[model samples]
Target chain A: MSILDLGKACTFSQMQLEITYKGEPAPAAKVWRRVKWQKEKVDEFKTDEEGRVELPEIMERSVMQLLPSEFVVSQAIVVTYMDEEYKIWVNSKRSPEKNSELDGSDIHLKCELTDERRLVSDYESDFLTSCEII
Target chain B: MTALDPLNAAELADDIYQVEDEFTREIFYEKYKDRFELGKDSGLSDTGIKGKTGGILLKYPHMMAVMIEGKKKTSFDGQAVFAVKGTAGLMDALTDLNAGIKNARTGGKVHQGFLDVFDSYAGKLPTLSSNIHTIHCVGHSLGGALATLTADWLKSTSGKEVKLYTFGSPRVGLEHYASKAQRSIGAGNIYRVYHKTDPVPMVPTWPFFHIPDGGEGDFLLPSGLHLKPWEFHSMKRYIKSSKGDGSQSLEWSTLRSRRPQDFLDSSVEAWLKSNSIVSFTLNSARLLSAAILWVVKKLTNLLGISVVIAGSTTFTLLDRLAMLMSKGLELAKDVSIWVTRLIKRMAQMLGIVVREGAEMTMRFIRQVFIQAHHAVSELVRQAGRTLH
Candidate 1:
């Protein structure tokens, strides 16, 4: 199991995640990102893929889990790629707000799941409890 | 009204000192001494009331003081007149000088009305019980009309004298103040003030009577000294150059504004926080997603791929995935909302219990305080008896 961390600020944008089966070469791997308030699989790639995605940028941002203490997140994000589904559970290590106005409004468009599966929609989906950072 | 239109502030100020104040105090008395006296048979009393110094109107231009002394309902001393200026509305086209609420918003006049202006002269009026002797009226535009009507009303009442001074009063009535008011007010006391810049008073309004070209109405007085206004084109002569009347201008806006500590007030801050959260997430996502879609679209065209084929394929794949996620989120949302509502009801129940408990405790504490006071008083009396 590969752990993925996609952390963000109150005003963060463009969250992405890629998935690969164990022992699969990078070229055979897929990437995902949050799109239009809904989770979507916009691209398909592996280790040998030609998409110019940078690695350090996503890691530098993975400072903490989405939720710190109360609840353990089962998975950070789950992507249904074609017939098969890819799942990654991430722990969020941040404090919960005493008051949350709404999930998407507070922190929306967070994680992006990229794989060979094209799963994003024209209309955005809300980000409420879709992913557990902690 | 003279065919020469009307005199402007600049024109009136000129040749004003020459015609009126030019004569010594003796000369002023001589000119007006004859006309003021009626025919010998008129039976008018020349009382000590006319002993007042200076031109009656100009000396106290604003009726700067209104005090009620001794009896609360006594007749007022000095003039009780209100000058209302149409600083805004259609009347703006009528006069160069505008004052009041209409002028306040336009930054042309003080916002405070004539009744409440503390900085300017205040007219003292006795309480509701007193009979008002007279109410002199002066104004330009809509204000002018209101003043004339007020004066007319005062004259018709038990009051023997009601003097009116208007500056370009618009036609008050289509046929002159309901006829009876005209007769009671009499033509003698009404002085209609006017200037060339004041296009408001003529107004094609009825009541054909007009102010004469020479300053002859009621008492000819300079509206104010416009000497510095006309001679030098400098605005400083007319308006104040200081920040606010030499620093004692205690304005509400100055005292109560959004200060830095206001953020700590919490109640107001919470709304701002909530709105920003909604705005930021929704807005940024919209722009980013649209840009991505645009890039995908442009690249698809450049690759020589059939534009429609690439567009539809990409859209279809993303659309299906979005639809599924949306449905799931909606379900979660419905559940979350229900939970929140249930929690609210539980909190209300808890609140009722807590409030009852607090009230009972407070009652017990109050009873104890009363008992302690009585016991202390009894012990003090016992000690006094033993000492005796």
Candidate 2:
């Protein structure tokens, strides 16, 4: 197989997610990873008392046939807690190849208190989505 | 973050370094008596009771302060801060030169000289037993080092929040001491201000380190300006640099973020090498010419030539040699200026890299390293040729 074919083979990696509010662990927050364009939910998880969640292994797949030849499938993890939502994007091409498990030390979701407590507004969601990918 | 006021801290630090004669002390008290109640001065001796090594105490309604004095003479302070010998009589000087940490009564290891100085005055300090909201420790140079130890001691013993402000402090202790002190005093309470070119803050050269807890306020000279290292270390310069604004300069709460310990560690060696090269290049030619003239005069007198002939011959030979030496000195000066310009260019290039947001890229870093190596090597080669 060519190097591109080898790279396209199914590979699994576990992502450990942590949620913190002002440097303290935030527990029981709702989290889910979804495809950006399709709005299709891939998985859902919740943080434990220590504000940690270990997602099941994720598979890397090439979506060349579903979209354009250069298009790649990516995932965005959305976390909602206490009137705030944090979005973390994961690029499949940049995922670690050597390690089967990735500790989400850098994947910490910082939750800030909103000035007004209410449902997540569409404007806020769009703003967060359009902001920096991480 | 710190309960201790920055203006109060700066005033205390500036006051401690002044000449501590009775008249000066009275003047200092007069200036701040409305805000602070001056306490007894602690002197340092082998017994911790009879010398000029300890600091004075200033008590406010909510806070108690320990202000340690720097060396009495500016020249003495300069010498003591840079001396590499570990056996120096000055407690802070010895601490800077000493390599390792020693056990403290409070359960962690600390710099031995610092602990010794603190021990000498720990009993006499009234704040040790008080219910003060904060204990402020302020000093400059050697006194700055002592202030750090005092803050650590008070934090561990009294459990009171300790605020430390040091001006151009030398390295105080090892990594363990720094970590422990950070924990005890809370990182936000330590404010260390050093001018960009100050040499005092660069030693007891590596392995020894200072991680300022609050954050380091580095006062850089405005672009294209240079101050002699001594001038950078001066309390007057530090005061002027602050422009009487007592608050910490920037709001970066994290300690050692911009200039990490490793960056400082490496800079110490670079600073020393540059200083030695500059001093030797500037002085060696003049010294050599003076020596040659002295030898010629001695030889003429020893040969018992007639006074007139001796004087005339010596003048003729010395004049020719002096002319040659002047050319050499001029060449050395030119080389020195070129090296300085090269360094300035390197700094400007690095500044550009930082401004361009390429500082973290491996390619940019490698390019910088390569350029720096070439410049340093060229400087070394020039110095070598001059010496030859």
Candidate 3:
């Protein structure tokens, strides 16, 4: 599973990550959860020196959550086809944000590591606003 | 097609005159000179490529990217072909084999590399037409892979027959894509060239050639055929060479090469007949250090039990732990010494590797941007995704 079950779903807990022999952290590791996360309803910040999105809010966010720059669209992530590995993409959708004249459907991503060490655009879905009141 | 274009084996045999006199390797360096430097956004790098005078881009990667300048000269009939300049690395070196030259990723990057191989300027392909004419694609090493990708792209997009010419290319397809690619660019259409001793076109697994254990149809598994962005990314630098039109001065011809087999015929032959020691080794000190770390971690989690002594002589049941504690400390110190030394060495290596890798990566990313930009610019001229 992309996110490991640390048995802390919806509750407060600290989690450790499973590392592969290759020395990279699993895509989704279980870390501290349910801590008093302070997420601002509005987020506008740049990545810190570490290239991690140090959100003012308690919750950490992925790069996809940021503004759309050519940078995000130009990265790579590996996925296996049949058994052989071929790289598809994690780049900008080929279609430009122009009038409906072009192919209008260039949906591919670079799927790679960017200079920031963040996985670029490969956003599963664009933003959909949500809210909860206490 | 020109009088020189339609080269039958016999006709091709005659034209095998010395091309070395006209085209030297210098054009390869001259055309993509800017690639020797890096982009402002990418920061700087030291690629350590050859013939480099003092310049901004240093390190291996900056050497990877030379600026790509493209110019097209038509056939006598005015068909447009493009030439660019860039450098090649592992990916290009690997995919320049007969088994390696297929798939969009392998092809895409290799094509870019081919363009970058020499200061390119060559015959053009006719503008988009339904007519079945062939696009002649060619390169060496990574450039060869790029040649194959260019042909594949042209075949898929241009609705033209693709005549590919490659030298020492790597395995382009996993077991999956090879068959179909082989068929599309028939033996007649595709001429994969290789000289005797070039180990480069054969190493590295990026141009994945073998099928998993008992996986599938050829060494290429079906999954490998999916030309995804990652695949192209795997060999992007090689693709940089596709921006080729070798010089009015072409590169040193492979035909001029004295095949490696001829140079070391007997020893190589004997080894092929009998030596089979494909092995890798581990460092003993490193292994021992790892064991020490594992043991220390376990001990750190255990609770320490202490007992107060009522008299001059203190007798405790769990006091045996004293010996264990001392031993663990000694091991920990040893491990620390080794670890610190190892870390320093690793840091030195990483610094050099990452610095160069970053430079190559930066140049590579720029080319991807440029290529994607080209595709975007051409979006205006693109018709719907309908096949001709």
Candidate 4:
């Protein structure tokens, strides 16, 4: 057995994520985060009328664990709208360093969709999977 | 209908302006035979006009004098109108630009270039006649500026009520010229139609103003439809804006209620198409390996195995080799995910940079305009002090 140091763990005390399609708010969208190993949803909520959802305080230890240096543990915030899932993966090491503070922690996602029915059509899924993860 | 009618005058002016596109005079006459009979093509080389100037004079039974022409080289003479200098070559354009209220009301000094042109047409050509019955002048862009000057000269010389109609015309004079033209022509007689975004109407920036005679008829485009600045200044766009009811016109919609992922997806598809087949195949292989590794990981966790053994071990060499392969697949999966995330982040940053750059450019333009306005005002004030 080998021991590993996964760096300092940080918690987002309070942050709001707003998602917009074009310029308008996306209401009633389901947002959730699943555990890495079990794939069990750890947090879930629906966006308000203004397309805003307040994220729960996320402790790093709950979503991250020590593995070999070469292995990475990733967490993703998934938003489901119209039976389609849009994933925003959080880098455990980078997110805490960049967004550990409450000042610039808020995220604004602007999604641009060209077709409704064929959301993940060939070519589109590759380019648009990460529309604007701000 | 009377030529004084704004809509009729604009339509007729556009039609007359279209005459320049004809290869031969016969083609023009053939086309406009019903509404107008050609009087003469002025400013041809043989006509004694030094420059390559051109203007078409059309004769109608109800309306005797109707002239439409643009600048010789610049198509509309927009550059000439902005110079605002009173040189011999640019006398008409300068006169039009400087035709203040005093000049408009009192029939002040007229440009000699315009006077010479008028005299040549009125005196030598008997068909042209000394006095026009009902003078109507029309032009677009620089042609529009020239038309304004022509209309003013006709009003002064013939003492007839001349009706002026200009499309996308720049400012003709200083404040006084605008006031005088407004009063002399009777605001109702002048019809200026301008599109909201046309840069022509905004020229000769400060102190100078567009002719204030007839109330302006503005053509505004619908919102959200992004058009280049020059497109807004185009005559074709102006004509379209004039005729359309705004409902059926091409415009970008602001609403994004449905799946907003399509735009990204399509762009990705385009990028994929633009890439080499080798790169695409490599990416596919990476993705396939990642997927396979994920499935194996799930199966290993279900089987309650904490670690997969590999390499030189006390167990069979084949079993150790299989374990090593499993460890390698896991590492590959992690690396693949890392690369995909990195690419996504880079793409997002590029988009942000582009949007911010465009916004900064617009802000800079606004700042420059404000600074230029202040600079011009200061120079004018300094000149006034020197005169005093």
TM-score of chain B of 1: 0.28
How far off is residue B144 in model 2, in Å?
1.3
RMSD of each: 40.5, 25.1, 28.9, 36.1
Stretches of candidate 2 exceeding 4 Å from the true structure: A1-134, B1-7, B39-101, B128-131, B213-224, B244-388
Over B1-388, each residue of candidate 1 has an lDDT whose tens digit, in order, gives: 1111122211111111111111111221222223222113211121101111122122232221111111223223322333333222222222111112222111221212221222222122222224434444444433454445445544544364655545444444322222344456665555554432222333321112233212234222222344221111111111121112442322213222211121122432233223222221212222222222232323333433221222233332223222322232234553323222222222232232223323223233233323322332232223222210
- Count of steric clashes across candidates, in order: 44, 0, 97, 15
User: Rank order by TM-score, top first?
Assistant: 2, 4, 3, 1
Off by over 4 Å in 3: A1-134, B1-86, B89-132, B210-388
**What is the Cα root-mean-square deviation between model 1 and the actual structure?**
40.5
lDDT of 1 at A3: 48
Residue A66 alpha-carbon offset, candidate 1, angstroms: 60
B60: Cα error in model 3, Å:
14
lDDT of 2 by residue, B1-388 (tens): 2333333444455554222221122333434333433344312111111113321211111111233222333221211110001111342233222233456655545555556655655566543223234556667665677677767776777665666767767667654566677777776666787654444554443224574522343322321154233345545455545443443433323223434222232343244234233322212322222233232233333443221222233332213322333333334553333323333333443343244322223334334434433333333233222210
The Cα local distance difference test for each model comes to 0.27, 0.41, 0.27, 0.38
For model 4, the stretches where C-alpha displacement exceeds 4 angstroms are A1-134, B4-8, B15-26, B39-132, B213-224, B245-388
Off by over 4 Å in 1: A1-134, B1-79, B90-132, B158-160, B178-180, B205-388
Error of 4 at A52 (Å): 66
Cα error, candidate 4, residue A115 (Å):
51
Residue-level lDDT for A37 in candidate 3? 14
